[model samples]
Target: MENMLQNINSLGLETSLTLDDIPNIDLYMDQVIQLFENNFNDSKRNQEDKILTKTMINNYAKGKLIFPIQNKKYSREHLILMSLIYQLKGALSINDIKVTLSDINQKIINDEIDLDSFYTSYLQLTGQNVIDLKKDMEERVKDVKKEISEAKEEDSGNLEQVLMISSLVHMSNLYRRVAEKLVDELVVDKEGKRQK
Candidate 1:
């Protein structure tokens, strides 16, 4: 009876690995970096892009802005999360977001939470209202610069403030989108897609 049971288990394992049964997996680390590099070249060198530099990336990776999978390589979901984290460089500070993400990941690993629900909660917790804050600030900066140009005020200080605020607003928008998108991509189950 024991040998029969063992044979059945082995058969089950083999069946699970069939091409049709393979899991809907996420993208790997290399793929994620490639995505970043591609975007970096295509985009203009704005304040948003500057924050995605080597120093910031290293800080985020070391700070646990991203979670590491053991034994197995990272999936597309992980890459998406990293990219999202990269976008968030302006708000919440590096350490703050990292700690929040780590706590969330722990809940996931412990099975105390499901990804979809977790994603929803995270979105609520982060507060999407701040995305508008960025947009408003950027618009204000633009308006100010337009006024300055009309007045022909060539004071470098005012010009600098306008540029700085624009950069901040852009970075804020970038980060908000990153966190939101990462959650959206990671939380859905493959079975959910079958219904669609």
Candidate 2:
């Protein structure tokens, strides 16, 4: 169990492209697809899973989750927006993502924030959170191991299963709370008042 935990901890680190990594020149659809594929290839769960697809890109554009293409080409801003959408989609509903990104998109359009600045800040914030989460996971593992050790012999077999389920439920609840807070911050009431 210790060896397994160590191996899991040593798994490849999650990575994101920096602002400098995105091409300055506008990219055609195929180029955009290829870029996303290259970056997100590791995220695929199976051979049948696609990191990004043309249909998904088109759907994002259609759903206003990303900026509309200009002259059949995507700008750096588009790539950044798409990347944000990709990351959030796994944890958020489409409508939630749309609301959050639409707010950001408006800010970009109004020149309130440049894509470079926004993406940089996002990377910094999330990178820090990732570090914190790793520490939290380590602590949780230790706590679970201790709990399992203290369980009655007859109950020992089920302790690990209980811990796994409890951990997943806790994590899901945490995600829900964060998502709700984000929605509260981004979405306005019907009378045009900010909920937060």
Candidate 3:
């Protein structure tokens, strides 16, 4: 065991010590659980609730959402993304969310469309309506499928498709509500004009 540890270390594996390997496994595990639970509750909600449902967590593990960590532990960014998805709980289906996200990620491929900047812009354009958001979304969907097809031909995971998909999904959810509201407003305006 000691030789194996040494060999792993020599290879720069940096073997981690689990609670079981430590002197007080139970106590350590309890502390870890408590800390994780506290963080999970206390962390600020992003634009959306970000608190993931059990199904969401499972889907995340299944590549529906991607994070560097394979375990349940999630980063702040993941939390924010999850919250955004929470906002779209009723408005969009998981499949639609996946499509929208892929589009947003495709937009990010070039420096011209920085997601962070786009998010800020999305928020700033607060009063603007999203009547066309759906149409735009559909177009984006077509584009993403095209991108996926191109990538498939290349036989590549050059960007880790899951990560890109998850990240984009987060962005789409964040702005979806605003888009919905905008669409509603447009409908009302059109109706009013028709009545006039």
Candidate 4:
């Protein structure tokens, strides 16, 4: 159990890709899949897990979550949009992700910010947040461990497991609430424009 906890703690310390790691050139579907697979390898829970598929990419385009491929090639903008979808899909509904991405796409279309600048800014902000989240998780783990140590003998084992699960649930809830709020903000803004 301790070893399992240690492994969980060490999980995301190694597998993230920075903005510079993303290729600037347009890539074919297979190359795009390979790029995502290599960068977000940790996302797969098992060997058979598919991270991103051609069908899924097509679906995203059809769903308007991503721009349509150009001349059968995906640009860096497509990669960035797909990456955002990958990260958010676990915690957000497809509609919520669509709303968020739509807002971003509108901004890009308006020239409020170009894709490269937006992607760079996103990477910087999210990288720092990930670091902060890691530190918070470590502290939570330590606190849980200390509490478990002080727990009565018969309760310590189950208590440790429960505490870890509770921490994870709490974090998930926090992220979900934030996502919902952002989605709500987008809805409100859209509604405001419609009323004008």
TM-score of each: 0.44, 0.85, 0.32, 0.86
Which parts of model 4 are misplaced by more than 4 Å? 1-9, 110-112, 146-155
Q: For candidate 1, which ten residues in a row score worst on lDDT?
A: 13-22
The true-versus-predicted C-alpha distance at residue 28 of model 4, in Å, is 1.7
Candidate number with greatest lDDT: 4
Q: What's the count of clashing pairs in each model shown?
A: 6, 0, 5, 0
Per-residue CA lDDT of model 3 for 117-158, tens digit only, reads 544454344213233443444555556556767767554354
lDDT of 1 at 96: 50
Q: Answer with 1 or 4, whichever has the higher lDDT.
A: 4
**Local accuracy of candidate 4 as per-residue lDDT tens digits, 1-196:** 4555466555653455566777888999999899988887774677688888999898898999986678989887788899889888989988899988997776655667577777778778877876787667677878888877877557677788788889889889997998799898999999999999
What C-alpha lDDT, on a 0 to 100 scale, does residue 98 get in candidate 2?
89
| Worst window of 10 by summed lDDT in candidate 2 | 4-13
Candidate 4 global lDDT: 0.80
Off by over 4 Å in 1: 1-23, 38-62, 116-196
- Stretches of candidate 3 above 4 Å error? 1-51, 61-63, 66-72, 105-113, 125-196
Task: Compare candidates 1 and 3 on TM-score and give the better one.
Answer: 1
